[model samples]
Target chain A: MDLGALFGNFNNFLDFTVGGLVIGAIYALVALGYTMVYGVLQLINFAHSEVFMYGTFAVAWTFVLLHGTGDASWSLGRAVPILLVALVAAMLMSAAIALLVERFAYRPLINKNAPKLIALISAIGASFALAEAMGLRDRFAKWFGLDDNLANYVAPNKARDVYSNPVSIQPHGLFHIGGYSVTDVDLVVVVAALVMMFALDIFVRRTKFGRGIRAVAQDPEAAALMGVNSTRVVQVTFLVGGLMAGAAATLYMMKIGSTRQNAGFLLGVKAFTAAVMGGIGNLRGALLGGLLLGVMENWGSAVFGSEWKDVVAFVLLVLILLVRPSGLLGEALGKARA
Target chain B: MLLEVDGLCVNYGHIEAIRDISFGVEEGTVTSLIGANGAGKSTTLKTISGLRKVRAGTITFDGKDITHARPFERVLMGISQSPEGRGCFPGMTVLENLDMGAFVRKDRKSAAYRSDLDRVFDLFPRLKERERQAAGSMSGGEQQMLAIGRALMAKPRLLLLDEPSMGLAPKLIQQIFTIVTEINQQGTTVLLVEQNAAQALKRSDNAHILETGEIVRSGTGHELAGDDSVKAAYLGGDL
Candidate 1:
């Protein structure tokens, strides 16, 4: 790790900065979902990352099928349509998964007046069950006709470099400007994340459903008095959050070019850290906290090398809590409790 | 009758709060339910507002049965309540609270909505000065005004008020009761629950005295105000 070599290498810095932006974007997407749900319910849906995980596999299968149709000619033009279809499919899948989880797992716990800690444990259990169900390679591959040996061969747990070719569909080479070399994938992730964030922010702050969500978040009983169905609003919150997580999953697969079974677990944790780091219930806080964390974590890794990447999240979380626990953009503990 | 509650019973887990209380509020009249603390006055109002669990009987408002309707549904069907403890959405502004109140109404962005808001402001001028202030940041009286204004925004056919004068100064109590009479005079039927039996009876057209979860006495406001036992028990012992 020559100091001069690493500094002179614009590619690594690009991977750090640009990669951080894209990854931070996904984290922000996932974190927004977490923040919105937490804002409304004050309950963490730990299964959200598993929802992301399943979505990655769902999109991957779509891409593989598209690739098998002799459209192995992957280009920026082709990636766009494939990405759109895959995202919609993945969104529907994740939304259904979220609805079921809420209907059976969370709703029952809420009805039982179960402690918050128990709800968290149930969420973790659900996450594990979903992961296992998804990792059964042949079960999913049978649909793609990679049956028998080929089906078992394309295992999800394998390393990203398992392919001999290790395909690198670079988006027409990285463009350089000043100290940054912004890749096509980086632009895609960053733009998608921002678009999604803006859409959600508008939806929560502007739309009728958004007002209902805010009212429900503020006071469920009062929200109900206004003829706002608090329960339905809550369900829609989960549904929207799940949809974002699914889209994040698809963009993540495109950015990384590969994924693993446990991909979303660490990302989910970090994204959740982003949500908490920003203020659990505030929307803009989640996005700011995520991007800030992404940039800082990369900068920290640049200073201390790779081993310190994981430490960055914890250190920043503690420092933020010590200085401003409500997050950078969050106010006092007003609606955090509600 | 505008609002009829028959055999209404409410329980908290195991303990019963109200038992078979029956009442009818005629259209366009101010009806008040006054009782001592823990006598189930608020519970009756909560049941009518669809906020509490009703273990028995039916509630009909404007000839439509709405016993199992959701709280929001009740609001949409022209039934709204200013809840106890001044349950305003604390994080929101006065205007936002009013917006939430008008959640079921279509064309909320129309000029008519703004006019209704102006009416609330005219009724409670204190609210106009603090339109942007958070509801929780206001004083008790201001919060109460916002609560009533919020209920008015719903354009409810029946307005249920739970202890509107609780924790208010005597001067503020008089002001609120005066406004309550005015609100009723404007064609909004009010069913108010109050611990200030004398003031409530003085303000309402019809009155009911609740004791131990049952209506112990019912009459015109002046009759209850003149009754000796009612005065001895509730009006500060013959004040």
Candidate 2:
């Protein structure tokens, strides 16, 4: 561990913190899906990683379709529309996949009253299936007799190869604070995530639909007696979580500049860790956990080298679980709101 | 009849919880199913409310066949239940819990709904006092009140209450029975299941004695309350 590298440079520390927050926003968005689904079903949607993965492809495909890729100088005005389109495309794609997963993979097993472990295994299977589908898109295109140009543009030769955003929005420094720079990308990611989080919080706290969700989470039987359709609530929960993950996918591509076939796998694991760290069923906890995990991992890398960054995050998770099994915010979604 | 159940059969795997049970609740009446533990009282209410599947039965509520209806659909068609053990959302505020009860109503913002809410508060003023309190933190009796209060918020035509007096003090039990009578008088028909036979019989207009998944006897509340066999087995020999 290099002590000087860890704390000697104040400016470098600030940069890492800022970068961590940007990444944290993405993790928080993906984490919301895991936490919300767990809140209602008490089953982890391991396939949620695929939901995020699909969003990344959705955005990339949308850009390619719009003819917005490859060495194109994108003005702020022109980029705004393309960015909005990509965001919507990603969100829609991810949400669609999430609903499909709930409908096909989990719902049947749930309806059959299968054990929870069975549902978990089914989720893992669905995750792998989705990941492989994306990884073998070129083969799929070939089987479908897709046009060569379209196939090359959408699937590419190597599915696992890094896919870059065609219309790159040049990063402009927004502000300088204490010799640390804040870029437009970071501001967008953080601010957008916070706004979405606030919107979700309000939706859950103040809206009737949200009340139904919390009620189902607390007691499904009682909620049904109160006229809540538990099945519909579960579906809505998956949809909302997927939409957030989609938005996160867009922001992630903007900040990190590339995505791969297995891009969502590591990020999804980190987001799952964040959800558990913040309390699996609690909404606000996911946000807090994601940011905290991101910042801590960056700080760890600064001190112990980049190789130890993931190690530090996992160790922190283990330590936190040992201290507070329910995470920092605790595990009550309904209780927390109340 | 506001609600009718004919030959309702429910099973927990091969073991039957309820079998060949038949009952009816007249409009604006309080009916009680008095039975000992494992006599299928809770299972009867659960089946009616659609929480449990009916292996063989026909449930007609408001003249509509509802045996196969979904739980939420039953609630929308004017059946609401305060399930056994005061199944309140422990994490929610009293107000939020009540709001969930009104989930089926489109007129929740209307004055009618407001008055309905006020009527509940009027019935149980303790709920009004602790509207913002987390329901799980409240006392058992208070939780029972919240549970009943939550069911009332749905403005149901038929209300099914299972063991509202369970774990409650004698005075609180008496108070709950009084509220049940009041709620019945307010035009919602009730089907109550209780272990406290004496109180349930006294308050109910009609009563049934269930023993081992079957209705062994049924009569007007007064008639059953006065039966010798009922008195010996359920009413502690004196009531």
Per-model DockQ against the true two-chain complex: 0.59, 0.84
RMSD of each: 3.5, 1.4
Those runs of model 1 whose alpha carbons end farther than 4 Å from true positions after fitting are A1-15, A69-73, A137-168, A331-338
Share of real contacts kept by model 1?
Answer: 0.76
Write one digit per residue (lDDT tens) for candidate 1, span B1-239. Answer: 99888998889999889988888999998899988899999888878878787899899988999888878888888898998887788877888888888889996989999999999999899999998888888898899989989999988878988899888999989888998988888889999999888889888889999988888999998899999999988998654
| Pairs clashing within candidate 2 | none
Candidate 1 falls in which docking quality class?
medium
Candidate 2 ranges beyond 4 A from true positions: A73-78, A147-149
Best by TM-score: 2
Q: A314-335 in candidate 2: lDDT tens per residue? A: 9999999999999999996666
What would the per-residue lDDT of candidate 2 be over residues B1-239, giving only the tens digit for each residue? 98999999999999999999998899999999999999999999999999889999899998999999999999989999999988899988888888888899999889999998999899899999999999989999999999999899998999999999999999889899998998988888999999999999999899998999999999999999999999999999988
TM-scores of all predicted structures: 0.91, 0.98
Query: lDDT for model 2, on a 0 to 1 scale?
Result: 0.89
Docking class of 2: high
lDDT of 1 by residue, A146-235 (tens): 655454235543423222112224565467755666767777888988998899888887777887898878877778777888779878
lDDT of 1 at B221: 88
